[model samples]
Target chain A: MNTFVLLQVSEQVAAKSADMAAKDPHGIIITAVSVSVVFIALIILYFAYTFIGKLTSGQIKMPKIKLPSFKKKTAEVHPTPEEMAAIALALESKRSGEVYAAIGLALHQHMNEKVHDNESYVITIKRRN
Target chain B: MNTIIESLQQFWQYTGFANMTYQHLIMVLIGIAFITVAIKKDWEPLLLVPIGFGMIIGNIPITEGLNVGIYEEGSVLNILYQGVHQGWYPPLIFLGIGAMTDFSALISQPRLMLIGAAAQIGIFGAYALALQLGFNPAEAGAIGIIGGADGPTAIFLSSKLAPHLMGAIAVSAYSYMALVPVIQRPIMLLLTTRKERLIRMKPPRVVSQKEKIIFPVVGFILTAMIVPSGMALLGMLFFGNLLKESGVTKRLAETARGPLIDVVTILIGVTVGCSTQADVFLTGSSVKIFGLGLMSFIIATMCGVLFVKFMNLFCKPENKINPLIGNAGVSAVPDAARVSQNAGREFDKSNHLLMHAMAPNVAGVIGSAVAAGILLSFLG
Candidate 1:
């Protein structure tokens, strides 16, 4: 009984193998060829890129087109007495290691683009009123 | 009274509600699932949302004789599907991709392109397996292209070789591409060790604008000569890059990358989704195709990771590469590159691998296109 079962199983396995081979007769060959072709194509491209990289590494240069430059107008204004006092306070604050705050305050005051009356004059007028 | 009853019966028979089938209902549900995933999980919403909605429209049953569906002659949907059927959309899609692509990363580190080439092992691998599984040469070739992880190239090749499998091949390619992060992470971690993952690559050398402009031109001539079958896709890709890098054609490049690509993508996605009817799409072969597609993806990622590890054996200590970027070699574009960055960040926060990863990521695009051309030459 054991021999009979083993023989039948072997026959079934052979039949299945034959059936698969019949369906795709050149399966292994096609697989090999397709794989080789992909690698070969890529290998060719790799060398092409490498060769191009060597030939054109630093050989090409684009022409520089010069553009006309336009200068913007700038006006410098004198600092008010209040501004000087603010700068002094900022510098004093720097001595206590608040350098960033001091520099920020000084730059903000100096960089303000709007024209205004001196802080001292404005304060005096308001006090009098 | 008898005439009126007959007229009512005729109307009921002609209605879409009476014509609907279980397959139609199943396909519509699948479409709804696609939309839900796009909205909730945010996976490739740009492509998925349109494709999902188109699937719903495709599954709606109409009268047998009416020219209304994508398969029907002279139908509106059929007109839109011509781009996919005639293999016109992929090349135009390549044009948009080219205009927006910056090849500096690949040019600066050209050797990384080999990892992209090596990743294509999955294509050939899957091709062989498909053949053994009883697919004919043409169908096997189309199925194998799904391994490239490039939707346009896959569509182009399948449309030429096995037009019947185009829908299944395309849907599988795009779906796997969208799942790059989910699919590639574990394989990346498995192949790479902690030490290998920690390896930091040298920053890419700054490529000049002149080199950039010449690259597309030189690449066009060389690659076109190698595989003439790939000219439509490769030629448009190079032309688009030239438009962008030439600096004088900013308007053309802008239009190609922006509106032109958007329109083509919409058409490609919608048509691909609409092509998947229940009777045609849900076949035994489709199940096998999906299985092969997943295997191809995993094998491609594995090959890339292993190839990098193999390359490290010869390189000097200073020139060592991180294996994390190897996953980018499968050519899903920025998504695969972004996955590399995310994986790297998991190990070392300071490591920025996006630029490094882009080299292989873009190279994979070229690699897949070349592989497609070769398959076409052999099988088509």
Candidate 2:
């Protein structure tokens, strides 16, 4: 080989070796930086979550307030005693086959008499399933 | 009669038994052992059963260069194996894991995330050790990740940086993860005092739906920004979590967590197992990888336990952490968490640390993924 060509080849090889050497430093630095990043990021998230939990709990107490008491008008509509008895009678008739007819009869009897006595009735249905 | 005998001999020569070697017989026995452990011990049966059967199939010793092995160019096994070789299955597994994971535990107690970070000491420790033992930087990184005890992450990083070591690394990662109870229990018992083991963590606070939904978004943004190479693994993970938490994507979430994950797990386990041919797997390097893997796993477990003990020094009495749950920081998921709870129960039957352990366990998934990303970006 000629002297000039040998010098050129050696220079190229040295440059390549230097480049490879540079990458090792970079790799070590990256490893350290990466580990640090993971720790830093997680620690930051830890604090953020703590702050968020505290904020979202909404624990700030509100001051007590005093208000003037005022009497207000209320609705006066109430079921009459007869109507109440009819309602009870209708509900009691729900289990029988003639429930509609019984309900009609109860309503008619309550309308016919201005005052009605309280009565309770029980009925049961059997299922065949 | 002579011609008939010759033809019969020719036919027999083509059979798998004709080509079988002692290595194949040994691998078959190992495969059976895996299956026995899966069935008898009930340790990671979902993974071990498939992988074990695949190992048997892989070791059947067919005629050479017949295009039938997993390494063949056009075989069906090779095609299925691409999901692993090309790094597809791991991210999909992560997606399913995300859909199934409840970040509520980690969110409720963020300090536990530090334990997850602490567990990553195993990765670096193993990496440095592997380098000293003569692996190149890329192969060392892949071996180190087995210490993370996250099989998918190990497979993902290996597929990128050290494809030749993928089989050993994957097998080692899964084996250690499956043996989390055996490996972690002793270290956990030795590291923690009885009082530390018995410390019952306060109940985790209830996380709101809004926080659950926002977590994936914020977490993805933060972690991905730091390590872009992890986007496939970490992105799918967060996306799967978003599906579950979005409330409107119930069907997608169900599919991701159910059929999708099941399918990916089978593909990953079987393909990884099939990659473990006797010739490729019985190398000196494979033995070293396995050794480093066990060491990394033990170191990671110890790091987590020690970290908790260290943290306890500054903790108030009421807020002191139980070192038992620290094993979960190695990222074996519910298995490690279960071990932590079992260890805690042994110390105090009344103590239940499963929920608390879950926080670090799931956090370890993200931690390992981040570490994998860093290694990939640097070494890849």
Q: List the residue pairs that clash in candidate 2.
A: none
lDDT of 2 by residue, B239-354 (tens): 99999999978878999999999999999888888888888787899999999999999889999999999999999999999999888998899999999989888878899999
lDDT of 2 by residue, A29-114 (tens): 54567668778767877877776666667653456686644322223457889999998996786476587777778888876783
Write model 1 residue lDDT over B200-236, tens digit each, in one string.
9999877878778877887777777878888998899
Candidate 1 lDDT over residue span A1-129, tens digit each: 221221122333334434545665666665566566656666665676666666666454556787654332233456799999998896676355476777677778767843455563222333554
What candidate 2 gets wrong by more than 4 Å, as runs, is: A1-31, A59-129
Give the proportion of true interface contacts each model preserves, from 0 to 1. 0.29, 0.25
Q: What is the DockQ of each candidate?
A: 0.11, 0.11
lDDT of 2 at B8: 94
TM-score of 1: 0.80
